[model samples]
Target chain A: MRLARLPWWAIIIVAGLAIVFYSFFTSPLYRRALIFVTDDPRLTTTRFANVIYDVRTDEGGIRRVEGVFVGQRGDILNVETSRQVTIRVPRADIAALSCEPPASEGDCPVDATITLLRAQISGFLIFEDMGRFRIVTDDGERQEVRKFDVIIDAVQRTPENCPPSPEARCRVVLPLNPEREANQLSGTVLEANADDFLIELAPEVIVPVRQSDIVAVVRYTPAECALNNLVGCDSGIFLTLFVAVIAFALAVVIGLVAGLMRISDNPILYNAATVYVEVLRGVPLLVTLLFVNFALYVWLRDEFPKIAPTLQLIIAALALIVALSQAWSKRALLKSEPSSFWQPIVAAAIMGTTLVAVTGLFAANSDLPPLSRGILGLAICYGAYLAELFRAGIQSIGRGQMEAARSLGMSYLQAMRYIILPQAFRVVLPPLGNEFIAMLKDTALLTVIALPEMTQRARIFAADTFRVFEPYITIGALYLCMTLLLSVLVRAAERRLALPR
Target chain B: MAETPIILVQNVSKHFRTPRGVVHALRNVSLEVYPREVITIIGPSGSGKSTLLRCINRLETFDSGAIIVDGIALDTAANINRVRAEVGMVFQSFNLFPNYTALENICLAQRVVRKRSRKEAIEIARALLAKVGIPEKADAYPGQLSGGQQQRVAIARALAMQPKIMLFDEPTSALDPEMIKEVLDVMLQLAAEGMTMLVVSHEMGFARAAASRAIFMDQGEIVEQGDPQTLFTAPQSERMKIFLSKIIKH
Candidate 1:
């Protein structure tokens, strides 16, 4: 019989690549390139662009006309006048520029526009003049020849320009500094106003700012004195490091208890472990962070007026520890148990309940301290998963082994220690490695609580500059690298621990 | 020559609480085993031969009995482990620890129960393995060996404990036909060495060759007891005659 399907991994990889590619191409700067190609014909013919625009480089240096675009054939199309000059091009030499409706009107026109516009511009724009064009389109259908406004939108000069469109209107070079011409831009704090602010630029543009679009308003306040307190730096670094260390230590302790409890013959201990795992694993880390910040903090503050902050941290850690331990122990127990039909279902149910409870509690509190709470939350969540790894390792020994040991006059504990556990642990190492990597990724969940882990640091960096997408991409790549490294480490460990052949 | 028997059983009876209700496995069985005498118990399946042997080591508790081994009563927990140590038992399945090498299997009881030093235990294990005719296989795990080799290892393991009496509970029952002779040879050698052995087996030829006295059991009670040659040549009881006829024909 013919095979019924595509390989599942291939499908998943293709889907993931598609998503990453889509996100990259649909970003704002990328969208600008698509618009450039659709509006300027000179960019299409020359396949090059020399765009003079201000850019903030890595060292925070502001440079004007930082880059120039050269075509594959050494042609250079200046960004200025490229759009207007496109009107003079003959139909035969126009190459191609096409405009298509956005996939979703409510959503931004990044993917559909770029994909369609790139196909139209590729044939006409030699590889060189691709960087000069600046294209603009709007929600409304009306098309008119207007001077390009480069200042209103911060434009960065890069060697690469967007591909052209089928309509020969691929590149549009907006005039620089229209605001400077009109004398409307201002950087100085002339007035203290909460709703509006003005910033002066060398080459500015006049653009109407809508109230709905503005997210933040700030007034500049500068202090003349530079204090070398060093206290702030110490406390910030210390606090972050402290949370990470404490969370890991607490996770180890709680994991042991939970693991033991989960395997205990007593119904109460087992059920409690089950409940703990479910509640912890069920909730989203963000919600857990919020609960710790808001409700937990308030409750503790009320309960202990003088030591409320200390108690809040303690309580959050304890809650996280309990949650993590519960999760770990239950997982360990399930892993240790013989392969029975109900084992996985029972484990899943417990995990689900714990996660849901944790998320609910976290959501209720939004004002908790970020780093400590986030670390604690992640520790608790992954502790359960780790516990199962331990359990699986311990339980992999055969029953016959125990029986044989006992028959040889050895006690149960002795048999387990000498004959069974060593073998079982060897079997469990690979999965344990996987759990460690998973736990590392789970550290990102702390971002919800405002702990400035790598991802959170990236977020702060994004917010400081308005380049949000790059920071996120950097964070994603970092996470991928760390996880991949961990995977390699685990594989190495597996090989080391593996039984002979 | 009339020293009191080393082991004595008086009106011993055992009942098993199985899933199918109570089974009266042994009924008013009585026997005496003298020092350095080989007594072989021959019976069909469910004849309580193993239960009787296990009772001596207290591996199986008798419902009603007074068993005396080496002047110590067998019912008390105080002496159970001690009695088990003194009376080494070998099972049909060999029950050797699969993970351990044959030498380790032999030395385990010696080191753990007897508290022998590792060096002493190893020496004893090597000697016992050699006695069982597979000394070269002492370093092999049970899984790495054949059924006959494992059984030999099991015999060596039991012998390494240095028990006063050895109990063989169908030691050759689980072996392949070709492997059975090797295990039987070991037992025969043990018998020749004058080990006070209580053996439960179906091997009529081994019983004739090695046993000083042979007992036939049926329905949890001994039906006949005699010299092996007389029992085989001319059975006294109708049950004995019938049993012999059936087994001999097979």
Candidate 2:
């Protein structure tokens, strides 16, 4: 084709490239090559574009500029006066053109220093010397100016320096189920620290409070400069994403194991799977959910707290190590030399012990609300469904495939890893896509346990505004769009898989 | 006869315990296949021809029998993987892993089972694909290939492991009549290269042209055994004669 007959898109792209090239060459990073350094003061007034900077002769002095420039010639400054005369001044007579004056003005007699309180101070402040403060004024100057000069423009208030007395009555809230008659501790603010404070109900009863109690400390009597700010409704998305991500990731692994157990030849595996399916799969998801949130999780945090979960992690580590070694070891357990085989085992034992020991150091009350407990509960619930999906996908593969793999001397795990599972994944793609959508919706149920997901977040807004129609409609549309996006992704994957290798 | 048998099947019998009754798939089926010998078993369906071949690779478990392949006793040891590694089997349906490319199907078993490095496995797979005369189809998925091409890939997949013996259970039976020749031709090439093979098929021409020994089976038992020339031209048993006559009529 002739260059003039090129496609519209090609012409457009070439035009865009030319524009980009011009912009790139003219950019500030390449300014040295393009920009002319001028000291000519009279060049300020121009038909040709130029910059005029008004600079202070001395520090703390104002410099100003005048007029939309009319014209300039041969370094002569034509100043357009407000009275209408275009006053011309010779460039030789002008001093210097600059943006700002050099430095701070005269010092305050050597003994004066200041702590600048520029913006509004947030939260409470402890015992700090409040003298000779430097601040940024509305006029946009950072200086240690006279305080009495600004006192007329500010609300002068008396300062309270004394700590709250032991007899000072207050209410304390702990981290627990808000519905239950728990977490409410009535006390007095005894003393304050950098992060937390000591509170006392009576003279001899004092309790140390940690910041993560997510507390709001109130005084019985108001102070001189008391501040109360309303922090808005936040059903944080990070918290929701955290729960969904952990739940889904764990569920996939759990599903794989349970599905394998169902297909295993051992009677123990078969019986274990039967029990898992009958009890967890048969029971209502709500029952297990509530029980974990209200009962078990509470007990772990409040009663036997640290011991139970730490022990479980230790056991989990041990089981994982054992399973990995048994499945993938290159050497036969009996035939291999002890030093070669036992090294990994010893290392794993040491690691597991260290894990247990590390967990012991922190008296971590799983202060996690149902937000986290719901993650655990949901993973267990969905894992069962995914297992059945996995089993169906696995079983649908031709028996000849397994025979072919095994005839190649591959172990059961090897065959499953290399051959069977990869094929099964292809077969189960549409169903797995559906499961992801189901999982996204299931996260909404977490709100029943008082954890906020998207629906719960919208509900809060709806409740506050008393406008159900708009919020729900907006949320429904958002959810449908998200699901449609997921569908698009799944369809793309299907199309990719359908392509010839 | 001086060289040890590549495959020795002794008194092998297998029965299926279906809901209806115990259907005997194999009954006292014994045979020896020597090194570089190509043996073909011809019979009608349900005559234990496929069962007897599958037993050598322990793909089917026998009720009472012994199958020794490459000096490793099958079913008598915990690790049948050793026996499996030396003996490769190709199926009638091709049984190529649908997820993998023709080259990947060949490379997978070599990497996973034989523990060949990726580069080494790919090199061998490409060679085998070339040997099967579809060198350009190395990157094509099994689903993208024709029946003959897919079967050739399956044969190459089996060959990639460098098995001591190759089992073909009606390899050409599932192919289109036109496509059957391509698969049979590859098998004939493998035979010419002195690969020990045991095939079960009703392809009289393949049996006559390629096989060193021919066996006839019926009612889950071997009815007649001899050279391809002796069996095809002059049958010994009444069942063999009737089976040949029926096949010839078709």
Candidate 3:
């Protein structure tokens, strides 16, 4: 009903966000991109592709080459261009090769031009005809502008000499062609090295320059090259959603079962559920998450096999029997209670999944991936809270309903399934929605385990860019959008499910 | 009538443990109802009349002795459901499931416990609704119906199982003055049709008209019992006289 008062624009915005979130979460391409962005750079084998080389020549100029690194010979580094031609450069000439996208400010480069020395005028630099010296510009007026001419140990540019664009970095005078004399033939520098380099004097006319130029090579890769292309932070949003949804689902199941056990008359089940609720709820979610990720997983990995075989057999047998019995019982009521027919199947599936997960613990050589461990921790912690919700919901029904149900010859389980649980489900739905939204927001805590969820991605981005407010604010907004979308959906569902008053 | 008793309650004693102390709810209560015979039990609050009816279907477990409904013993846990199926009960508050319609309330037990087909259950439910004189109210929920109509629906829900014996625990006590007759009329009709019944109520006029035997209970024990004609006219015990005076005078 509160949603009814919302303006049309607000509704449209929420709906649009819902569609966008749904599309991103469902798209495999997006998922793969997210993986590429979020995966550890050191472990990724594809990080070397699409490399840009900054080679310093014997002349004190830096030449930018965009290429893939082919195999290297004794002292020659083979760099293949987009046109499939491999250029061999001495290893000493290659100043730096970077695969990361350019970040803001200092680490990136500004434009410059280079002037060749007169020493190699005729013998090797025959392309520069009748010139005492040739000058080459590294900025891409002659080609696509994709390279950054990184300058090191250069004079800082003042505000008066800044470029037309006038950025914070534009203040520095580029070190590429630092000096331009009275008579020098300026060409387009294509590729350069310490031995011999190519310079384009005109269109389609490239010639080589020899090592004996009147310049010295001096350049170093910047100390702090930020991996500031934080597109991967978007992947973190999807990851958080995935963790929240899966953990919420797992928590619901755990809560339902544990809630039933808590209310049941059987002492063992009751006490076990009581202990689980007390212990899980008493501990902080972060502590539980960390313990599960760091401590519990290690213990489970080592000790799981010892108990798996026997527990596996017992559970398997129990699952089979429960499935068979439920099927047998449901056959008669199938026409009347069609939905109830799925109860046994769901029960069997839960049991089967538990068995598989336990066995997987034995089969796995290492702890579960951080994402899975985080999800597990979230599920366990939230399950206790949800169990309390379920218990309160169940208990909210009066004693007379149970008595009336029982008086009709219905078994305890039958009464609960047909009568109590349906009502309880309705009662608990609103709180369940709240819990889901809470869990979605709580996924931010999983950053400690390095789960690569949205918050984690944002943290990494913040750390990399050294800008705290931007990443955190962006991630916070994303979380709010998701939670709002979820709230609207839940409200819609509640309205639909509301009993005829 | 020398026919076999449909329900036999023998020395059934029950107690409830409270934070205060153990309260004896039923102290060695015993009774029997022959087929087609209607018995009415009158008692004060906590006199064990409702507990006796509840124990008949094993809703309330007895501390001592045994209960047999239509020859099935209540001592065994396995027989509880079977025994319940054979014995139907109506509560004072008319506990018709709020989630269900009048028809669904009647059909639920039949389709579930009786393993009747949905169509069969619906058919039976419709007939019972008609029999209870509220055929038009079948689709209505308990909340939509009046107190008298709800109680009638509760009766129909119990009868949907085609139980051999019916128990009523102060069925008309919760109804308003203007509504009590509708429910009593239904019970009287059931009595006329010879459905074996054991009702606990202070409705003396209905008891006098429909009951074959009348019982008076006090302090968790049956004080007096006889044919309704003699019991209503002249009670034997001092406790029965005092209880009859307290209820009848008002």
lDDT per residue as tens, model 3, B9-68:
888888999999999988888888799999999988988888888888867767788887
| Per-residue lDDT of candidate 2, residues A1-501 (tens digit) | 476987898677557545544643554212211111111112122222122335233454534433323344444434333322111111221122111122233211111221111212112121112332233222222233232323323422223333311111211111122222211222333433343223343432112222233122221221111012111112434344557678888888778767766765445455676678667788777787888788977676666554657575866676465545634562444331233345445544654565466455323646665656898888888888888888888899889888888777776667788888887888778777777777776777777787766667666655643445544544454455557678768887877766364
lDDT of 3: 0.71
The fraction of correct interface contacts reproduced by each prediction comes to 0.12, 0.59, 0.47
What does the lDDT read for residue A319 in candidate 3? 65
In order of listing, the candidates' clash counts read 63, 1, 5
DockQ, every prediction? 0.12, 0.44, 0.26
Q: How many backbone clashes does candidate 1 have?
A: 63
Better of 2 and 3 by DockQ: 2
The order of the candidates by lDDT, greatest first, is 3, 2, 1
lDDT digits (tens) for residues A1-501 of candidate 3: 588998999888777656645644675323333333344322222113334556667666867654544334455544445432222222233233221234332122212123333211111110111222122122211111111222223423445444322012232222332233411333444564444344444432122223333133332121111244222223466567778899999999899888876876445457778999999999999999989998988887777667677777776776676567667766754543344566656756675678667676655644576777898999999999999999999899988888989889897788988888887778889889999999999999998988777778776765643556545555555777778878979988788766654
Q: In terms of TM-score, which candidate is strongest?
A: 3
Q: Kindly indicate the candidate among 1 and 3 with the higher TM-score.
A: 3
What Cα-based lDDT does every candidate model obtain?
0.60, 0.64, 0.71
Candidate 1 local lDDT, residue B83 = 64
Displacement of residue A148 (Cα, Å) in model 2 is 35
For this target, which candidate reaches the highest lDDT against the unseen true structure?
A: 3
For model 2, name the residue pairs that clash: A300-A305
Give the residue spans of candidate 1 off by over 4 A.
A1-417, A420-501, B10-20, B23-30, B41-52, B60-66, B75-78, B214-250
